[model samples]
Target: MNRIQRVQKELERANADYLITGTTSNMYYLIGFSEEQMERPLLLFITRDDYFLLVPKLYEEQLKQFPLIVYRDGEDPYSKLNLKENSNVLIDDTTFSLFTIEILNRFKPGRIGRASRILGKLRQVKDDEELEKMEKGVKKAEQLILEFVSNIKENMTECQIERKLKSFLIEEAGNISFDPIVTSGPNSSMPHLRCSDKKVKRGEAIVIDYGIKHDGYSTDTTRVFSLGKPNDPLILEIVEIVKTANEEAEKHVREGMRAKEIDYFAREVITNKGYGDYFIHRTGHGIGIDVHEDPYISPDNDDVIEQNMVFTIEPGIYLPGKFGIRIEDEVVVKKGYGKTLNMLQKELYII
Candidate 1:
């Protein structure tokens, strides 16, 4: 179903009259527009009877393109017009600041709900268009990784690699989904390590994690490579274990499966290999307009897997003061199984 149909269905379920506020992701999902006035707060009022967009006076012309009610700041449209009371209003929790909340409460005090929580749950499952965009994103990210690894030189600092990756991604994809992670040697052991001036040495494993954005959709992926020759057999072994676990978990993923179960399937593989403790963080998380979404693949998540849901299946083992290896891939849940979006080779690369 299209986004409007999905949202109308949600309105029926909630028995809400209107949903208000201007969150970029939610607004893009509801109406096929990402206004340039995103820096200034805007409000999208969606009701069963009407659709209204409230923007700053400066964005009046842009709002006119859409066929809906437009409310500008300089004009007191609400006062001039009659707004029905007791109209169930859904507000974006993040966009509605404390001051805005007070104003909204004074004006429309009836049944107020939060759109962030509701829409978050709805966005967990990807539709055909969303999946297509994410697939493109993943392909671009994989290509960037390949290019980055091919040009890697000895004694290159972590910052140098990160800068190169960012430059390539911006030139090719327009923008990166998030900050690229580049760590070499012992620094790779930190899952969220920041890039530094530490130069990479021969026979050391370097971890590169990054994602690309296309049409507001994102795909996250990570890969580990060894410089020169393979200096640590344990690093290679861990990579293989994580890769196998990721593959095995994808096999069991289908509609109706619990998210936590998928995480356990991958975790069990690493545990059986006696490297469970080294594996930190969740197996993966839902990906879409935002890098992280709902229906996350973690021990604490109980959300069930559904058809059209897209997420990453990344498993890693980090041995502190040594090296870390992570293999990640984006997957789309289907009827019988999950389909991998990333085509990059999973075998440990020796650069």
Candidate 2:
């Protein structure tokens, strides 16, 4: 069935009278209509048997292919909904408060609920077209990494590398999924550190975590690099441990397993080596239209792994005031196994 039909089924199962959402990823997924959200109200209304887009006159022609209800400038768009009071309605979690408040004041939905309850599960198991786009995104991300590595040299500031990576992503991949992280030496201990002007030096570990956007999909991966042999032997040991953790987690990814099991597989490897406390953050997160999504591989999430669900498996160890090591790879669950999408070698590279 088509996406709208699938959601209609969900609405049926939910016993919801109607499903309403604004300009968001959820709306884009359902009807292929996406635009930067603005004050102008653009909404999608769906029911068990019918669907329509309500947009401003400015978008009337742009979205002509779909069923549309258009309002010109200066018109109160909310009045067009004509929703009945005490109706059962589901709203997108991403809907703006301006619209939501109007909904509550006007419609007084008998039961207001979040659309994520239905959209989240449907989005977790990607269709073939999404997988194709995601695979292309992964290849673009790998290319960006290779270009970054080829241009690396000693004494370059982390900000310089970050700028170059950004340019490459915009030029080659069309956009960036998130800000590229280029941390060195002690700065590497911060898993989400913003790039700084500190010049990378030999014998200090460097953590390069980045992602790019390709055809509306997101790709994320992390790799460790060093200008030369690290000054501390512990750096190499930690890298190996993190790499093994990433590997074990990927190896054990199977359909029907809890999302937390993936975290345990990686955490088990790190904790066994006596550095569990340093392994901060969840093992991984689902990556798709958004850089982060559902089916997160975290210790507290019990979502089951399902076929065609794509996510990441990253494990790390940080030594305060010293350095950090993280290895990450994106994987897609198949019939009964998980396959890594990244083509770059996980082993630490000494330049």
Tens digits of per-residue lDDT, candidate 2, 1-351, equal: 998999899999999978888888888788877787888889999989998888999888889999988999988887777776897788988889788888888888888988888988889899899999999889878876876687888889999999998898898888898999999999999999999999999888989998998888888999999887888898888998999999999999999999999999999999999999999899999888878888799999989999999999999998999998999999999999999998888888887
TM-score, structure 1 vs. true: 0.87
lDDT of each: 0.80, 0.89
Per model, how many backbone clashes are there? 0, 0
lDDT of 1 by residue, 1-351 (tens): 756566667887888876665656688777867653344456677766556675566667776775544555666545433456767767765563652564366567478778765688788877777778888778777777787688788898999989998898889888888889999999999999889999988888888999888888987898888777778787777778988998888788888889999999999999999989999989999889878877789988888888888888998898999988888888898876799887888887887
Off by over 4 Å in 1: 35-39, 67-89, 93-113
Give the TM-score of each candidate.
Answer: 0.87, 0.93
lDDT of 1 at 115: 75
